[model samples]
Target: MAAATASSPLNLLGFNRKPIFHCKLSSPRCRPTFLMPPGRVPSNSIARTGRTFSNPPSYVLTCLVIPPPPKRQKPKAIIQFIGGAFIGAVPEVTYSYLLEMLAMEGYLVICVPYNVTFDHAEITRRVSERFSSCLDSILGSGLPDLGLSALEVSDLPLYSVGHSNGALLQTLTGSYFSERIPKANVIISYNNRPASEAVPYFKQLGLVVSQMLPVAATFPVNSVVEVASGNAWKLLLDTAETVVPNYDLKAFGSFMTRFTDQLPLIINELAEGISEFKPTPPENLESIRELYNVQSTLLVKFDSDTIDETDQLEETLKPRIETFGGKLEKAVLSGNHITPCLQELRWEVGNVYTPADALGQVLKNVSVNDTRRLATTITNWLDLLSH
Candidate 1:
């Protein structure tokens, strides 16, 4: 079979994988999904809208939790993983290889996917709170007894793991919500740039395109987002089974139907958030020092990532971690910022090795062994967490 592929890709980002939600439509099945656009206070969204306009379309913090290695009698640790940028919203598909590798090592992996938004602080809190609630629900023995309903990791060390933008959130969750996050944070390809730099280049392209429009021409942002959403789902449909873990194509039609239904409302949320910044200070620095209780942080930086802001993060975190005797470790891996986003790609040659194998090899990675190396490195790091 051929490896999962993207056709003339949009560089990176912009796929809205509808979650298998019995809860909310926005979050990825295990999670809720919402795009908070710029300037909107995420808290204000929760302040309960007008009596008529309730039930805002947004993501809840549901996560995909894969059980530990099937053969292992006892699991080693539990990982709370968040991805970066737009791909972060569909981490099970985008970061499946690395996460699956971690799972095979007897780590119970919980992957939290989030929509892209300027309100990182708000999004982080949503992710953090939802993770707590999701974990409780999973462990509470809820109705139907889902896959991992009976499993218990209460005694196991809880590690906060993240990639790219997720690294930023994990750092915050480790710091702001440090009490609940025992063990340490495993931050990979950390990025914490402000709104301008943080937003995807795809949105930036939209801005550029808008500037070139005729003076009399007017276009709705919803239409633009809709077009983008359509293209993204197309890509997902083509590659789901290959990239996403055990994805069932039977759900493809339903997924597309749901994505189309939610696109307009998601766009409306984006439009409404254009000018609302009620709960200001988009980051949490005031109380993290005092509340920062996590024992340590492992910062992973990529060699070729010019956009990576882990150095700045290191400067901020090193002092805080060492203030009361905690370790702030660092590692520079080889790859671009998206190294951790690599998915497993292989083509079973029908008769003999074909040119597609060469293509697969190229598409597998731009950097040599970055994904597997990352998985092994993180595995070793998490193992050391127990010591």
Candidate 2:
């Protein structure tokens, strides 16, 4: 007769709040649960072989290693990753995460650090040489430093993934090694504009700096200026703080040194490479196509990436690729030039009551992370082409 309480078994309508259950099936149905999609990788299961520096100091190579998953029964294919201009194999953790994704998917990946020499031809040649040596070391002699004894690299198909200028280098490598290695190449953010076009002031600055202090030209002084002027390391540092907070700061000195030492060489190479995109005779275009006879090529361009030259490049090369019975696939994605490699950060304010809320969005605008979706897109493309 007492007033009903919230926890009372009977409801206001005089019926029990909890409903009785009736089982239709004699036994409960069992359904399968999968932690991840079939054939996809679990992050924690991936293994890594630490970076092994190329012997003989002048070679100046660092092998960025990402071995395959342990449980896979069959041998894995290889992917050679070439970093963008001024970014060597070990510049940042973002690069590491991207490579790890490939490795996690059961692919053995070798990352060639950025070459100081801007000459794409020379860089391609050096990369090819080192790639062969690295392959041999893994298969036959077994380089102890690379933990190659654990891998079986014999006769496996090789593919290439290059970013920015490294994509240019990959193109050259594909052309040069068409017969021997690399079945195809995946080029990201391929920009073919002249270096001066991209940075008009860089040419003038280089000219003035050369006259004012030629000695500094050889000493990588320009690199120091860029860092101090907040042109180079600002975004990198900010991104690292949010995405990879414990990343070592000292590594920046080595990275900057490498970048600064070869600034002039890269500028000169850019000039030459960009000019090749100018109007050429039909015969010249035909000859250029002959040089790029790889089995297939995949070009990934960002929808918002204004710096890309792959559109122009594809128009010229597609015919050549088709002539050779090869295929060319172009994919346009969202974001800017760096979107494939760097993720966008979303910053939100805890409350609007404070003045700090106004600054939160501005700070968030500058933050970045490594784009996992980009890596997945590449993996899917590889799968499509692998068959």
lDDT of 2 at 96: 54
Candidate 1 global Cα RMSD = 13.1
- Model 1 per-residue lDDT tens digits across residues 1-387: 011111111211222222111332233343313333332224233212111111112222355566554456556766888887667755544566677778778787777756655566777788887677666554444212223332334445677788887877776676666346746687887765644354445345444544554541466755655565466566765676565444444334333433354444333444444322212223444334445656666777778998887777666666676676676667777778877876545434456778887777776554337888878878876676565
TM-score for candidate 2: 0.64
**Number of clashing residue pairs in every model?**
15, 3
Weakest 10 consecutive residues, lDDT, candidate 2? Answer: 1-10
Each model's lDDT: 0.57, 0.55
Best candidate, lDDT = 1
Tens digits of lDDT, candidate 2, 1-387: 111111112112221122111122222221112133222223232211111212211111235556655555443567888877666434233365566667777677877765555245566678777665455444543334434442334435677888877777777666666444576678888865554565576556555555655465466656565565355666766676465444343444344444555565655544444323222233333444677876667777776787888777688777777675666777666557766455233344564546666665655444333245567777776765545
TM-score of each: 0.66, 0.64
